[model samples]
Target: MSSRIREQLLSLLLEQGDAFTSGEEISRRLQCSRTAIWKQIEELRKEGYQVEARPKKGYRLVHRPDRVAPEELKPHLRSQRFGWSIQYHSQVLSTQLIAHDWARKGANEGSLVLTEEQTKGKGRMDRAWHSPPHSGIWMSLILRPTITLAQAPQLTLMAAVALTRALRRETGLDIRIKWPNDLLINGRKFCGILTETRGEQDQVQYVVLGMGINVNTLEDFLPDELMKVATSLAIEGGRTYHRVTLIASILQSLEEFYDAYLKQGFEPVRILWEEYAETIGREVRTETSQGTIAGMAVGLDPSGALLIRHQDHLQPVYSADID
Candidate 1:
């Protein structure tokens, strides 16, 4: 049950691959008893790993769990910092909330909080995001960038670009960004990004970039209300993908874009975002808290706000839904 022993056991299984490793060999290698090895194997099975035990041959790792465990991801992750330290949970109210706490406690800038399921996940305009277990990527990244509060919104656009590239490369699907922070495919939404910040008027302390991606969710698993407007990669691509691979790709892409944004400013990120935008040069209805404005989608302004050309003037919409 101890993390150290579990990790040691997992490392041994991974090293052996399909070959079986005897209990005595495992205990001697890990400096533990056969009873301790057995306990760890049971724990691995509880975590969804399929470990097979034979008469005298010993244990062989059959299949890894579908869930996104830190051990499963650490091997594939290449990011220097973004995914270096991960806080994983089987289920939580929201990864965003946990990330906020971690940021307040001085968690590293690139540390990530990821969960297999979210019971009360949040979205734009106080909407509820449905995050079923093992069906989607519900994660939040802690960022402590030295950017002004006005420039924080640009991070959302940067995330959209990162996710767009990652999804395109992974699924080979035509993934596009629906202005502000939604990722769409074939005019249906499959991902949403919410960037929350804590700071003074002139400076930002930290930003929590939360992302919800429906990766391997089946069509029938979706709620009836969401069937019209929402979809999953599995539904669109006709297959399920390895969540750990997608997560690794997303973190690598995000760190690349984040570093570029820090060194070169927002111009580079803005250009990349524009290339994948789905709302430009089309008619859109933007619903703000004040009211709804329907017009032609022009482009993004300097501050990353959506530029909508109304009847006779251009309006910059800071936050709204594109319909």
Candidate 2:
């Protein structure tokens, strides 16, 4: 669906400033009915905006808060492919599920599916992701790489490197990667990445990289069960940072890393990924479908498969539960 009209409606509302304009004036100016204006305004409210309607005085934009609306974020986005077709939702079951469907239906590579909140969001290993309504950045990037399926794991590592670079540049908060695909702040979890793919053994049709970041969310907003395990940017930085800037930074970094990976292969990206990886060279406990493996994390192979140096030999861990 084209968000241009809704965006224009939002822009007109924002341009009017604090002046209370009549609904009839808005309808005449935007060439729409007062009811249409009222409906869109209510939709904006559902997306975490604060608009005030004072009797017959009409609608007043009390606040133009940072929302995932295309109008609010389009100006800040600098991607050529990523986010070119941005989808915004007030609340959804999962952005990953939406992105997967879009990809299957021929959504362009780097197309973004974002929601202010995700009701059935997912994390690594089909875990339930905590996406509070209108509190964090829930997004999924649809990527169609021409690389072989064997090389697909590199994309997850590549995403971690890209996100680390983006967080450092945007929030100025030192972020690190925890092994495969978790972002850490001060040794605590801040972000989780779930990379799901659909393809054959030698070729990949498309890949969905879903990232759930705790942006301006407060500690109290999270459940007590997660308070100690999960953290947000606000908790780490002690202030609220703009979500648009974060999104733009991530796209830019992802584009750069993706370009490098496509041209130079995963060697360079893997080196950078390892530099930011908190699991490398650290003692870790890994759980996989086969069983569990405890060893000193050596690093990653050229194919982005993690290398765990166990008692008698170096084991190539394709996928595992990391600790």
Which segments of candidate 2 are over 4 A away from where they belong? 1-62, 288-292
In candidate 1, the residue pairs with backbone N, CA or C atoms under 3 Å apart (3 or more residues apart, or in different chains) clash, namely none
lDDT of each: 0.91, 0.85
Given candidate 2, what's the lDDT at residue 121? 91
TM-score per candidate: 0.93, 0.85
Candidate 1 local distance difference test against the native: 0.91
CA lDDT, candidate 1, residue 258: 95
Clash tally for model 1: 0
| Residue-by-residue lDDT tens digits, candidate 1, 62-160 | 998787888778878988899888999999999999999999999989999999999999998779999999999999999999999999999999999
Summed backbone clashes in each candidate are 0, 1
lDDT of 2 by residue, 74-147 (tens): 76778767887877888899999999999999999989998888989999878899898667889999999998
